[model samples]
Target: MTTAERSGAVQDPDARRLADLGYTSEFHRDMSLWANFSLGFTYLSPVVGVYTLFAVSLALAGPPMIWSLVIVGVGQLLVALVFGEIVSQYPIAGGLYPWARRLWGRRWAWLTGWVYAIALLVTIASVVYGAGPYVSSLLGLTVSTNTTIVCALVLIVLVTVINLGGTRVLAIAALIGFGTEILGALVVGGWLLLAEREHDLGVLFDSFGAAREGSYFAAFLAAGLIGIFQYYGFEACGDVAEEVPDASRRIPKAMRMTIYVGGAAATFVCLALVLAVPDFGAVISGENADPVGGVLSTAFGDTGAKIVLAVVLVSFLSCALSLQAAASRLMYSYARDRMLPGSGLLARFSRSRGVPPYTLLVAAVVPAVVVGVSRFSEDAIVKIVSFAVLGIYLAFQLVVLAALRARVKGWRPAGPFTLGRWGFAVNVAALVYGVAAIVNMVWPRTPDAPWYDDYLVLLSGVVVVGVGVVLMAVTRPYRHSDAAADDAVRSTAAPER
Candidate 1:
């Protein structure tokens, strides 16, 4: 009883607060506000997200595709506000999983966690997988499926080793990534905008005759993946809530900060590339498959382009690191509650280092296996990664949907942060935006392609959710829990000091 009966004053405030919410502080609470925000910013990785998706979006929707960033930035900001409110109140590890659990119930959380966890793992695979070509180019190796997979595995191992250095190392790496990416974007984007402008601002409004089934709106929606992918890395902040003191207040601000700052950076990068593309017709017509590389090489010459590529590699590394860290926490969260199989093993925490070593391994290993799938077919990776953005959005909507339900049932958000009377309205807007985005993402547009390819995003989502449902029904994992459900409901009033 001695350890159990220690007064709140005897423990770190963050630990005490965790205890109030029925958790012990397993992560080191040494993260400053900027460190927290940097995690999200690095995870967001404006340089990585925009660069990878730029050619695809531009090819699909022309220069006008830049608007997708604005549209998604606004919509996701609404969702971010909703998340800010929920995370401010809960501030638990595993971000979405625990938030869903507290707001709805254990089962709702299981589905949310399952969908989100899968999305995250695949996302990690997608990021590192995409980085393979860059790595090959940088190292003067001939890029091939096998070589790409090798590079991806190497990146995974590197980030995993960095992650095992503990929280401070994670924060430092994130900040370095964030600073480098932003500075690179400013330099590259600014250079492109100022010196290399091939098309004027007028081109942004030109679709270059881009349309799907005679509907540019349809094409635009399909291209919306750029913005969707860029915005999610912000939630990585909330995933490590126990690691940040005053998390209830700081995490929400860090979340919103991530969106605001990341949005600006991403938009700047996209805008610069759009304005700098020397041959838009060639790019959209599929003649210029490597417009991103082409633009960099043309703008900066070989040596300068290589330098920029190095920066992009850093961004990729940081982004993967952040994603792995977030996924590990979600795994730990599930295992801590016995909500998943092998909970005990995954929940194994490093007291000295303050990290979940086993779950971190799971995060790294699963993504590595996914990267290996590319050996069979490179297109297979593309089709699989397409689900990443949609799966994440679907999982996000579920959380938003859960928050709305809890709100409708009179669970007014009670934390240092609240939307006040505006909470319900904002929550509704977030849900509507999320559903609209989900529909846009899942709408099959490519009729000429095989049915499987056209419907890949929707099919992948169904398969992930379907698998989650089957596992839930068979295992009933949520039945065994120590989640402090009662405390979650009753302790909604601004936790103990």
Candidate 2:
């Protein structure tokens, strides 16, 4: 028996648990429970999601659009439940990649990670670009194409620098972001309710003639897209699980808490902004379509609006930071297992910092390049964001599907968290919801546009995933090193038993 095991000290439970799952604990295991929760919470930043999409939702389906939040929230809660179960069993750093690998196989896991990593990188770019308008407005500057690209690039650099500081700095930043966003939501929503509610509660049921094709159902589905996009990012907790002590148990709770807290905050903020609109019709379809800015300005003048927006800008920055961190961790985890090209370099962790600096650089630079697409055409950026959303949902659904398969094959949960007898039902429901959400998101709304333009989201997602498939086919990674790592872990863990 090992000295530590015989002494009953178990020097590092996290390390031992990782070894059991065929991975090494190279990351700093310093994140507390709250820190883990904060990471997920900030990644699912309600302030950023709600603020960015408020106008779009309002324009699509009016106040009735808020109902999508409840619907998508419930659906996503199901997803979070399944993810909680999986992460509890395999609380590795790469999140879906490692989970899929253990549950399915190398090829499937590689595709899952590839799709998810690409989605995350694109998400960082989308989020940074989304913040451009708010930043420009706060700075009282015109939001030209050049200005938007410059602002997004600057935000990406800032986030990359913070991530390079290591896990502790990330935790600190996430906690600050959580505090600011929650406080902002409650304070702003409450003030809007008390000081600027122009419409009655019944306005929530009004569709505002958005269903021009005579089908309210169609418009509602379109509006539901906003909620679909908002509720993800909770998986960021699982992505960094290896960096947290007692992660199997704690990460599950943190994932669920992310959805609960983030969903409530997003719902409250969206409803507040909807009710606070001084002229709903004008804000929805007329000259002043910026409902968030309009409501804030109406409630507390231009100066106060800018202040609140500046707080939102901070939230945006933190959201981007958390995203880059999650993406880099996923990359590092994949490379560490020899599952990607340049695995040796990408997997190298800084001895002093406990971070994969090369992966961090890739995470930062890719998003910067993506943001450059904004310079070509604003519509291109929109399509890219749509692709990001679709890619993430597709990747998530893949994992859910794999879990269902595992369940059928009699795979049992190995950790403290489980759905018990309800696992099968919840997994099935999650799969159904995930598929429905993906179809809803990818369905083309603009029939009049050119064919290529109309199918932008679908095309973008396919192209990205196709490239990953091609790369996997050509390179066939994980044939040697990953197997060796698994053997090494098993041999190292054998003596502990």
In model 1, the runs with Cα more than 4 Å from the true position are 1-11, 486-490, 493-497
Identify the candidate with maximal TM-score. Answer: 1
Model 2 residue 283 lDDT score = 56
Q: For candidate 2, lDDT tens digit of each residue in 1-497?
A: 46765344245777777666655576788788898998888888998888877777777788899999899999999999999988987888889888888777788889999999999999999899989888888888897777778889989999999999999999999999999989988999999988888888999988767766657787788778679778998999999997888998999999999999999999999888888887767755756767777678878898898989888999999999999999999998888888888899998989689789999999999999989966777465556667888999989998999888877766766577888878889999999999999889888888899888888888888898899989988888857454422121122211100
Evaluated against the true structure, the overall lDDT of model 2 is 0.84
TM-score of each: 0.96, 0.94
Error of 1 at 157 (Å): 0.5
| Candidate 1 local lDDT, 1-497, one digit each (tens) | 25554664356677666777887666788788999999999998898789888888898899999988899999999989999988887889999999989988888899999999999999999999889989988888898888889999999999999999899999898888889989999999999988988988999999887764378887887788888778888788999998888999999999999999999999999999999898888888889988999989999998999899999999999999999999999999999999989888888999888899999999999999988876876475456557888888988998998888877665778878888878888899989998998888888887898898788889989999999999999999988996765234455544222
Candidate 1 residue-wise lDDT at 93: 92
Task: Provide the clash count, candidate 1.
Answer: 0
CA lDDT of every candidate? 0.87, 0.84
True-vs-predicted CA distance for residue 190, candidate 1, Å: 1.1
